[model samples]
Target: MSDLKRLLKSSGIYFLGTALNKLLAFFMLPFYTKYLSPSDYGEYDLSLVYVNFFIGIFFIDIYVAIMKFLLDDSYKSIKNYKEKIIFAGFVVFVICLVFYVFGFYIFLTIFDVKFAILLIFLGVITYIHTIYGYICRAYNFSYVFVFSGLFSALIGAILTLIFLIYFKFGYVSLIYSSIISTIFAILIIDFNVKIFSKFRLGFGDFSFVKPMFFYSLPLVSLAFSYWFAEFYGKFCISKSISLAQNGYYAIALKFSALLLLFVQCFKMAWQEVNFSKILDKNMMSDYYTKAINEYIKFLFLGSSFLIIAIKIIFPYLIDIKYYEAFIYIPFCILIYVFIGIYEFLTNIINKINYNKYLPKICIIYLVINVFFITFFIDKIGIWAVIFGFILEYIVACLMIMFLIKKEFIIKIKFINILYFLLFLTTSYICYNLNFKFIFLNLVFLLVFVAFNYRNIFKKVNLFNR
Candidate 1:
């Protein structure tokens, strides 16, 4: 298959899986808004930050090396890496367990014992599921991966509903369902890939995977910085504004994450294609440029559609209590648009063996995010964090452009940026004007398409050819 065709097939499989997994958020939003109060939602969101923090810090992003080594042509046998991957998994589990036990006692002073226990339990299971997922992808078992994800999501959704409707378990139901479903996913993945069965304490040489661990160590900092940049806003909102306001911000972010359904799938496919072609210097720069240009076009247009659709359907999708969240949805969605761009750039950086710059960039992002929220949150409420994230991404993209100038350059067209801003601005205006001005938003979408007709259709013609 051609490169583009391969990318599309891989992206399509991942897209189907992620769409179903994330559909849980949209499908359950109504039940969540109805059954859980704003305070409950706020607490649940906070709880998740804690769980994610555990994974972010201790998981150490070893999956990065797993993919790199597995896909590297220099590697003699993929099977040789399996035992080392399992060893790395064991190492991650033990470290997390140690921290969880130590932290659980400390947390009891601040949170309920049961809540703390459940959160740790969920975190450990999530880590296992995530590692297994990486292993499946590394083996190129795309069908297996998709099936596991789909089944996991379906089971989770069903269980969550049963708990919410029949038992009225509130936010706890969400946590419980996730824990159980992820466990099922882990089992399904292991059954198909049999990664765990390769584990033997003495069978794999720790020295073999030692370099991978060393490579992943600095990425732990990047992961932590990213985690803080994201969840710190919620923390600031809870303390400076109100838990209820934080709840509103959570709803907006969940809605914004809908765009990830596309971004992540593309990233998965693009990463596969990009890494596999790293040794081929001839087509690298030109392909990267074209891929990003087309990606930005897709990102901007998809984001515009999501922004308008959310505005139109906001009242029906969420409860009346969360109507205040609509104002933040557009801003949040725009943040992810830049995030998609950032991810693409980071992939390029990784492709060219320039990953050492990622942690520095993430640190810069952390500083900007913290400074913005700490100073302006009380004045502008959630808008402070939203604006901070937007500015952080813009600055990060500029930094990447400078860094990549020496060797690889992905030239992004200015017109794409202009239309992105214009589409978003028009949508915000129409949304604020309510349903009466919806036609104006439609006009902007059409105008964007009309302006980009050649760029869009040219790709279509190429794909057909």
Candidate 2:
């Protein structure tokens, strides 16, 4: 089978899974707003900053190493690293537990009593949930993978509903809901997939530790930098404006996250297929060019479609108080578009023996992000953060260009860049017109396809064979 065919097959399954999962979470927004005040959500969002930050640090991103070590036939000769992976997860949990014990006050300031407990629960569960997902994908348990995601989301949404509506628990409802739902998810996956059966607690020569550490440790800094770059906007917002305004920003951010659902589904399947035969460098290089070109084309067109759809429909779904959130959606979507591009560029970076450039790239992103938030946010409001994110992504792409200059150039159709520019101009116009472009958006969509008719046909032709 062709690489495109395999990607299609895997993506189709994952698309269904992610769509159902994210759709459920999206619908929960109405239920949440009906019960909780903006202040409640602001505090909840604040607590999550610490939760996600600390978890990113100590969670260690070790699960990715499972794919790194095991997917290739080359690693089949070496003893499987399953036990070592489990041991590493235990080490991560212990580290997080210690951090909380000594520095509990750091959390006590931002987190309420219940929120503090929620953070610690999240710290431990990160490793478990991540490792489980990676294992299922590695073993080609596609149904199990999809089921596990849907189950977690469904259980969490249902629990949150009961707490907020029937129990009337307020913001703490989220805390209660997440902790209970994740527990059920862990139990269900363990029961069905038997992930724990493969794990035994022994050092076993400690071979996997050294290589995996070198591979993953650099990623921790990148992860931390990513969090700082992202959270800096919220921090600036809370300081310069008000918590309620930050809450609105968070809602916009959350809505933007739906786009990632598609990106992640594609990524999950892409990683499995991409790595398995990636040692054949020539074919991999050709595949990289073709895949990235299509990815870019899809990104612009899909984002344009979302812009129109959201303008016409999303306003009615959200409360009138949040109707201003419509303006933020376009910028929010741009952030993830750049992130999706970065993920694609990693195809080149992943092959290099040293990852020194990766951290350097992240540092550049962090500096730009901070400077923009500090200087521009107070003057221009939330637009600064949005522009900052776009600039950072541009810098990131430029850095990728420099790295690949000495090695290889991943050529993409330049017309796609033109399409992206056109979409950006149209989106800005639509936003300024207060989304009165119902007829215009339709005409633009039709014109867009007419302009790219050959490319669209070419995309379909890839799968015909």
Candidate 3:
């Protein structure tokens, strides 16, 4: 099969899982907003940010390394490599556990008890899922992994609603639901481990273990720096401003993160599949260019929809108290789209083994975020956070482009820009005029779909022929 055909086929499976996951979460947003106060949701959101950081620091890079090593034929037979991988994962998990305990102590001593415990629990769950899920991906069982994620999310959302509405558990419902979901994911992955048992586990081979750790160490640093910079605004808000302000900012983030679900799934599938592809030089370059162009086009359309939805639908979904957050949604959506682009671009660097440059780029973002948030948050409030994110992604994107410019020429197609403008114009008119006509949004979406249909048909025709 052609690379494009394989990409489309794999993307179809991934999209089904991602779309259902996002739709379920989007449907539950109203329940969460209605049951939990903005402050409660804010604290919940803040804890999850810490959870993400901890998972990255603890297991994410190692998991990536596992997949990379598994893909390499040389390390495929290192006797105990699989056992060593599992052992390494256990070691990292232990280290993170110690850090979580100490971190919880400091957090509870200095901050609120509820927030600290909530974060620690969520962090533990995230760590487990990260490790086990990576094992699945390493064996090319992404469909199973994707299905597990969707099932977990659906079950989690249902339980959260039940806990909040029936039991009146409030914020704790979120934590409980997440814990249940992670546990379920772990169980599912563990049950599917027989598919990769052909690879033996050699506990005594320091040779195999050493290279994996060496390759992963830079990525670990990069992950830490990346998460630190990305969450800087939220971290600063939680510290400098009131929790209420943090809550409002969190709502904006929640809305913005809907776009990220698709991006995340794409990254997951793309990394595994792209690395597995055997392509000639010409084919590889052509594939990369086509991928980037399609990525930017889809990103722009998704962001345009989100921007319009925030203006029209978000307020009705959340409480009136969160109305102020609506002003930040547009900027947040743009920032996240840039983040998705940055991720897509970074695949080139990953393929080239230039992982060292990632930390440098992240450090630049950290400095920019800190400088802007410290100097401007007092005067501009939550807008400062939005601006900080915008600056961070803008700088990250440019830095990645500069670093990889020799490998691929990054181009912004004029047609994508034209579609973006049309979407923006229609969204503005409909939103401002309070057009109750559902057909207006549908018409705009259809027009955009029609514009892309030619390329879609061409790809399908290529496969059919």
Candidate 4:
């Protein structure tokens, strides 16, 4: 198959898998509302952010190195596969376990008893799943990659129902579901590919560990900092306002999961294309430039075309107490928009092996978000959280672009500005229940589609066949 065909096929599978995963989570929200109070859910959300950081700490992010090494054909040919993977995996596990054990004591003292245990146990299982999952994809086990997603989501959703509705598990239903689901997922992947059997008695190629650590060390640091920057808004809301308000903000962001899921599918395909076709770096760089511009154009135009009254719809599915969450949805969309752009831009840095610069970029995001959310949150309310993320993504994207300017040009398409304007107006009108403005929004969306459909279709045909 041609590159275009392979990309489209992989992206299509990935999109369906990701959408199903998000749908399962979305479907569980209403059930969670029936069982857990908003304040209880708020604590879960806060704990989730904290757990994410711990997750990063526990993994050392060696999954990144796993996939990168596997994708490089030349490297894979030279290295003894069984020896390299085993050596790398054992070293990573030992280091992370030492850190986890030491930090477990600190967590118990600082956090709630149940939360601390959940964080440590859940982080371990999740990190294991992540590493195996990346290897599955990097080896072109796309079926395994996609099926594992669907299987995990299905099992998670079922367990969530059984725990919350039947067993009355409350906030811990999520913890129960995650632990069970990840186990099932690992089993499925192991059935298809015996990732663990790659282990040998001794290290045949301990040399792989040095380079892997060098590459992944930066990612580990960036992971912690990037996570802090990403979750700072929720931390601010929880600190500056009530936990109930933080729950509202968290729910508002969940509504943007649709956009995020869509972006995630593209991320999978885009990264694979870059890694697999590493030899054709020059051509792929140009492809990335166009891909990102088209990405922004599509999202902005699609945002204008959306038709959903989240405020009205949410009350029916969730508690009426969170009706105010709808107001925050539009702003949340912008946060995800910038985040998606920054995510796509990072592919450039990864390709060029400019890993050191990644930490500096993440620091800018960390400081920008942490500073604004900490000081201004009390004064400006939830808008402070929104504004901080917008600024963080804007700064991060610009810095990434500036750093890579000497090597490649990433054009911000002219149509993107027009789409952005339409996006703002349409989202406002949709939120406010203004029919006339909604009609106008549809008209402009139609115009955008009409004008750009031909060019967009052409650009996606990477093989020119």
Q: Please give each candidate's TM-score.
A: 0.91, 0.89, 0.88, 0.91
Q: Against the correct fold, how does model 1 do in TM-score?
A: 0.91
- List the candidate 3 regions with Cα displacement exceeding 4 Å: 57-60, 77-97, 195-205, 239-241, 278-286, 308-316, 406-416, 419-427, 436-445, 461-465
lDDT of 4 at 3: 59
lDDT of 3 by residue, 1-465 (tens): 665666666666677887798878878878877777777887777777666666556543667776776676665656656666666655555665787667655755675657566577777777768867777877767788888989899889989988999999888888899899878877787777742233234333444556666666667655675566546777777778877788888887778887787688677767776667666655556677778888878877777666666666786688787777766666677777777888887766777677777877887887887798889988987788788877888788788878866665565566777766755665565456655553577576768677777777654743352
**What Cα-based lDDT does every candidate model obtain?**
0.78, 0.71, 0.72, 0.75
Q: In order, what is each prediction's RMSD in angstroms?
A: 2.9, 3.1, 3.2, 2.8
Relative to the unseen true structure, what is the C-alpha lDDT of residue 436 in candidate 2, on a scale of 0 to 100?
54
* Highest lDDT model number: 1
Candidate 4 lDDT over 1-465, as tens digits, reads 665667777787888788778878877878777677778888888877777866665556787777777777776566467447646866776687778757764875675546677667777788788878887787678789789878998999999888888898788888889998998998898788767666453355676778788887877766776567656777677777878888888888888656777677777787787667644556755777777887898677655554343533566767667777888888788877887888788866777787778877787777988888888888988888888888888898998888877676677777678778877877777877666766666776777698779764666654445
**lDDT of prediction 4:** 0.75
**What's the lDDT for candidate 2?**
0.71
lDDT of 2 by residue, 202-227 (tens): 34446666676666666665567767
Q: Model 2: how large is the Cα RMSD against the reference?
A: 3.1
Model 1 root mean square deviation, Cα atoms: 2.9
